[model samples]
Every structure is written in C-alpha cells, then in structure tokens.
Target: MLSAYLLVSHGSRDPRPEIALQQLTELINQKQQSYSSSKKLVGLAYLETRPEPLHIQIKEFAHHAVLAGCDSLKIIPLFLLPGVHVMQEIPEEVALAQQAVGKDFNLELLPYIGSNPGLTKLLSQQMAEIITQAWVLIAHGSRRPGFQQPVETIAANIGAVAAYWSVAPSLEAQVEQLVAAGKEKIAILPYFLFAGGITDAIAQLTETLKLKFPAVTFQLAQPLGASAELADLIWDLMKE
Candidate 1:
C-alpha cells in the first residue's frame, strides 16, 4: 500500500493561492483516509515565481515521506495541463529528488486535473449558472496563448449548453470590449482556487467598469472548492 502522498503545484507569488493549495491537500488527505489510516500525506512546493524553488521543495517533501516510513509516495501535480511545467520542470526536479532518496521509494506521478472530462463539465455548469448576459472566463493567462485554449473550450461548452450570450475573453482584452459595448450583465468567472491578487485586480477593474456601465452587473462565481465533484475527481485519480 502507498504510505504517503505529495501534491506539487505551480506556486503563486500571492500567498493566498498557496494557502488554498494547502486546504486542497488537507481535503485530499481526508478523503484518502477512508481507504486506510496508515497513509500520511503533505503538500510540497514548486514555484514558477517564488522564493522556494521546485528542487528544494521536492527534497523537503522526500524527507517528510521517508521519515513517515513511506515505501511509496504519490506525486500529484495540481495543474491543468502537461505543459512545460509538468513535462520538463517537474520531471527534472523529481529525478534529482529520487536520486538523493534512492530506489527504495516508489514515486507515482498522477495526471493533471484539466485532463478530467468531469471537471470540464463542472466548469461549464458553473459558468452557465452565473451568467445571464455574457461570460468572460478569467484565467491565469500564459505567455503562450495556445495554452489558454482549454479555458476557451470550457467556456464554449458552457455557451453551447446554456445557449446563452457568452464569449470567452482573456482577462486582458475582451472584458473592456464587453463593457464598452453596453453588455448589461456580465459575469467574470475566475477559474482559480481561492481569492487572491488576481481576484482583487479583477474586482477593481469590474467595479470601475460598473461605474461607467451602471446597468451591467458583474458577478464573480467562486472557484471550485472542496465540492463533491472535486472530491470524486481526486478519488478517481487515486484509484488510477
């Protein structure tokens, strides 16, 4: 049986998002306990732009797993895709960590959450519920716009399902266009976990727009938290 777990995420400069990841880790552990009490788990780190680098975090996590008598450690990257971070960065860091820890530990890397169809459906449902006029799904935009298409796809699916007036907008551009066009009611769904700086910036922008377009009501749908669907998603990943 697997004795411990480690969840690695692309850490945020905003501490609040990191705190949200910790909450998710606890939620995962709580669900895992149903299978066995012996398994122990903790969230480790990796920062795209932060103080604690990926390699250092992995070493610390390996120590925790080893000290906990873990023969096996499940490494789940809490990300959407198998992009640069997942393909190159995490694997390289994990390799270094494995060399130091030796072959006694079995390391299993689970697939990203974005690959889950169920989660995509859930996101669509959430988007449909929030928007009566139009939707601009706000994501943590990447330098590579191609990486953003999954979010657009999810938004399109929501529009298809609802048959509602919605357009997928990058947080930077279409938001202002919609406001200018007299879109009466618009919802900006932050496709993120926890309220942080991005959410704050979103609020400021929308509120400023609200002053200009008083008729347009901007509501933010909360991120998918520790919901049953998310819990089941994690459970399915563990089973794999």
Candidate 2:
C-alpha cells in the first residue's frame, strides 16, 4: 500500500526550526526513495505559530496524498517530550483531519521521536570529544507530572542530570546545583531536534550562568540538527 509520512513539529516563530523541519522532511524522503520502489510521500506540519492551523494542514496533506494514490498516512511527532502538544493537541488535530478526510484513508499516529533509543546514543556522540564533565540535558519541559520522565531517563542513561525550561529545576538551577556539587566543568546539551527560540534561550541562559559561576566552565553543545543519523532515526520510527 502506498503511504504518506507527516513529520509534525511544534511550530516556531523563529524561521530556523521550520526550515530545519523542511530540510529533515527532504532528507527522510530521499532516504525513502533510495530503498523503496513505491516511494512514500513525506510532508511537514506544525502545531502552532504557523500560517495554517494544524487540522487544515493535515487535511491538505491528506488530500494531496490521497490524490497521489496513498491509502495510508503515518504521522510522526518530532517533539522530544510527551507533553500536552504530543499527548493531546496533535491527536485532537489528527481526529479533526480524519473527519475531514473521511474513513477511506488509513491514518496512524506514531510515537514521538524522543522515544527512539538511538537518540540517546546520538546525543552521547555529540559530547564524545570532551573529557569527563558533568552533563545536563535541557528540554522544554512540561509541568505535566509524568512528562519529565523521558528527559530524566535520557540524562540517567548518559550519567547526567535533567533540567527544564518551563518547570522547576530550571537550567540555571541545575547548573548551580552542579556547581555546588563541586563539578567545575559542565556540558549543557539541548535535547532538541532543531535550533529554535527555546534553544536560543538555552544558549543565553548558559551565557548568563557562565558569568555567574566565573570559575565553572560551561560548554553548550548544538541541538540535534538534520543529520543522516537523524534521518535514519525518522525512517526507523516510520517503519515501526
């Protein structure tokens, strides 16, 4: 059966994240074309801060896929956390899109990209060159009780600590804690797929923290951008 893959990201006012998502969509399509005779159509959608509402975009993509003879559509959330957007907003939009598209199409919502185990390894690779330093995985955390678990799990896997942007144990607080714990050298890794406003904020916060803890050395690593490994991760998620 012909299939369409919709890579949905949380929309951003900053163009960088949206551009990165489009680049990633192209990468995924290229990867799909390389292996499959029946090439799957790939598209991008955003949840908010975009010109089009998510349901409308989903409907448009679904219609386009249907016209291209795709009987199935799989949506993969590019979010790193199982926040309100992932758990509630996206599914609600998908339901609306399904209603708009009718029952003839097979639509499925896949797991968030962060659920991929390979991602932790990918993240670990980013800091491989550095010597032993306390690592902190920063994410756009949700106040929702269980949302922090994935970030915590990833941090634990890498022997690091977890910090949030929107919740308690802010990035600064975490850095302070690490300093108090006598960790002089620290690495702050943004657990994000692409560079956006939040990532920018993280960078700014790191700079401020560096000034605050004059003795402690803080190095901020780049976000997981559009890479072949990341494209492979998306393909694997789609296959699953």
Candidate 3:
C-alpha cells in the first residue's frame, strides 16, 4: 500500500515556525526519496492560529492522498510534550477526519517528536559547547498535571534545571535560585522547536534579568531549528 506523511504543529502568526516546519518537511522528503519511489506524499497541518482549521486540512489532505492512490497516512506531531493537544485535541481531530474520509484510507498518529530519546543527546551536545556554572531548560509550560514530567526528565538527563515561560519556577525564578546557589554564570536553553515570539520573549526576559542581577552572567541559546539531526529523528519516528 502506498504511504503518506502529515506533520502537525502548533501554528503561529510569526511565520518562523511554519517556515521551519516546511524546511524540515523538505529535508525529510529528500531523505525518503533516496529509499522509495512512491513520492511519499507529505503535507502539513496546524492546530491553531492558522487560516485553516486542522480538521479541514486533514480532510483536504486525505482527499488528495486518496486521489493519488495512497492507502495510509501517518501524522507526526511536532510538539514538545504530551499535553492536552497531544492527548486530546489531535486525536479528536483525527477521529473526525477518519469519519469524513471513510475506511478506504488508514490514518495513524505517531508520537510527539519531543518524546524521542535522541533529543536528549541533541540537547546534551548543545549544552556541552557552552561554559556555564548552571543551565535551565525553559519550555512553554502546560497547566495540565503530569505534563511537566517530560521537561523535568530531559533537564535531569542534561544535568540542568527545568523552568517555564507560563508557570511556576519561571525563567526568572530559576535564575534567582541559581544565583542564590552561587551560580553566577548560567545558560538558558529554550526547549522549543523554533525561534518565534515566545523564544524572542525569552531573550527579552534574559536581558531584563541581566539588568536585575548585574553581577550575574546569563547566556541564551537558540531554539531547535531545522537541522539534519532533527530530520533524522523525524524519519526514525516514521519508521516506527
């Protein structure tokens, strides 16, 4: 049976994340072309803040794939955590799409990209290049219980502390804690997929913190952008 791939991400008006996703998709398709001749039809869908709703995108892609003789479609979420979006929203949309497309096509939802163990190695590699007394992995926190565990686990694996943009133990608080512990030089790594408004906010906050704590040193790293390693991870998820 012919197979197709659909990548879903939290859409934004900033355009950077969407552009990054497109680049990643191009990289993935290029890699897949080396091993397959089926063209491996790939499409992108967004969860929110985009012009089209996710369900509409899913249906449109399903119809296109059906016309192209595709028998199955796999969806890979480009989110960092298994929060409400991963746990409830995407699945619900998929179910609705399935009903609209009928049984002629099979739809499968893959795990979120952040759950890949290879990401820990990636984060570790990024951290190793920087010299700092302390590090904080800052993510866009979720209010749902148990959602923070993955961020915390990743932080532990990288020997860094976990901080958030929206919740408790925020970037500022984490920096304060590090300062209290006599950690003057600290690095703040944004655990995001791309550089967008939130990542820009993180940079601004770092500047503010620098002014507040004039004696301390703060370094901010770039977000995980379109990289070869990330494309490999997406391909790995597809294989699974």
Candidate 4:
C-alpha cells in the first residue's frame, strides 16, 4: 500500500530550520524510495510561524496524500523531549487533523524523534572528534514534569551531563560544576536537530563562557543536522 509521511518540526523564525526540515523530508523520502517499489509521499509541517495551525497543515497534507493514492499517512513529531508539545498539544492537533482528514485515510501519530533508541548513538556521533575532560549535553528544556529525564538518560548514556537552555541549571551551571571539579577541557554538545537562532545564541554564550573562564577551553559542537543517520531513524519510526 502506498503511504505518505509528514515530518513535523517546531517552527522557527530563522529560515535555516525550515531549509533543514526540507532536506530531512527529502532524505526520508529518498530512504523510502530506496527500498519500496513505489515512492512514499513526504511533506513538512510546522507547529508555529505558519499561516495554518498544525491541524490544518496536516489536513492539507493528508488531502494531497489521499489524492496521491496514499492509503496510510503518518505524522512524525521531530521533538526530542516529552514535553507538553509531545505529550498533549501535538496529539490534540493530530486528533483535530484526523477529524478533518476524514475516516478513510490512515492518519496516525508515530513515536517522537526523541523516543528512538538510535538517537543516543546518533548524538554520540555528532560530538565532533574531540577529547574533553567533560561533556555537557544541553537541550532546549521544558517545564513539564518528567520531561527532563530523557535528556538526563541520553546524556548518561553518552557520558555527558544534561543541561537546559531555557530552564534552571543552564549550561553555565553545568560548566561551573565541571570547572569546580578541575575539568579544564569541556565539550558543549547541543541536543538539537538543526542550527538556527538558538544554536547561534549558544555559540555567542560559549564565547562568553570562554572569557569568563580563561583557563578552560570549551568546544561547541553542531546540532544533529539533516543527516542520513537521522533519516535512518525517521525511516525506522515510519515502520514502527
């Protein structure tokens, strides 16, 4: 049966995230084509910054997918944390989209990107070939209870301490702890999917951290961009 896949991301004002999402959509579709007899239709949607809400976007994509002979459609959330967005908001949006999409089409919400076990391995790979006395795996953070556990789990798996961008115990705090422990070289690994305004801000903050701790060396790593390894994870999710 022919199917369609929708890669939904947290919308960004910066153009780079949309571009990267486009690339990721392409990569996933390419992977689908590689092993299937017919190409699976793929699309991108945003949770914010779009004229249409996620439900409307899903309806539109499902409309096209139905027209394109897709019997099944999967909406995959590209979120790393089990916050309100992943736990409640997005599912509610998907439910609304499902109503608009009607009954015949198989519109389903798959497990989020963060739930994929392959992510731990993928994150370890994005660390850039560097030796450091300590590693800090920082995420965008969420206020939702228990959301931070996954970040801590992934960080622990990769031998890094988890920090947040918008919440308490920020990256600076983690660095402070590391410094207090006499770690001179540290790597700041962004647990983000793409580089954009926040990553840029992180870079700027890294510079400030550098000046603040003259004796310590900090290496900022790139976000997990639209890479094939990530595509592989998404591909696996579609099947799941």
Which digits, one per residue and each the tens of the lDDT, describe model 4 over residues 165-189? 9997899999999999999999999
The sequence of per-residue lDDT tens digits that candidate 2 reaches over residues 1-240 is 677889998887888887887888888888877876767788888898878889899999998998998887899999877888888999999998989888998779999998888988898888796665799888888768788788888899988899988898888888888899899999988888888888888989888988999999888899999988899899997763
For model 3, name the residue pairs that clash: none
Superposition TM-score, candidate 1 onto the true structure: 0.79
Judge candidate 4 at residue 34 and give its lDDT. Answer: 83
C-alpha RMSD in Å of predicted model 4 compared with the true structure = 1.4
Point out where model 2 deviates above 4 Å: none
Over 4 Å off in model 4, which ranges? none
lDDT of 1 at 230: 70
Global Cα lDDT for candidate 1: 0.67
Ranking by lDDT: 3, 4, 2, 1
Model 1, residue 214: displacement in angstroms?
A: 2.2
The superposed Cα distance between candidate 3 and the true structure at residue 69, in angstroms, equals 1.9
| Candidate 3: stretches off by over 4 Å | 35-38
lDDT of 2: 0.87
Q: Each candidate's TM vs. the true structure?
A: 0.79, 0.94, 0.95, 0.95
- Candidate 3 global lDDT: 0.89
- The lDDT values for all models are 0.67, 0.87, 0.89, 0.88
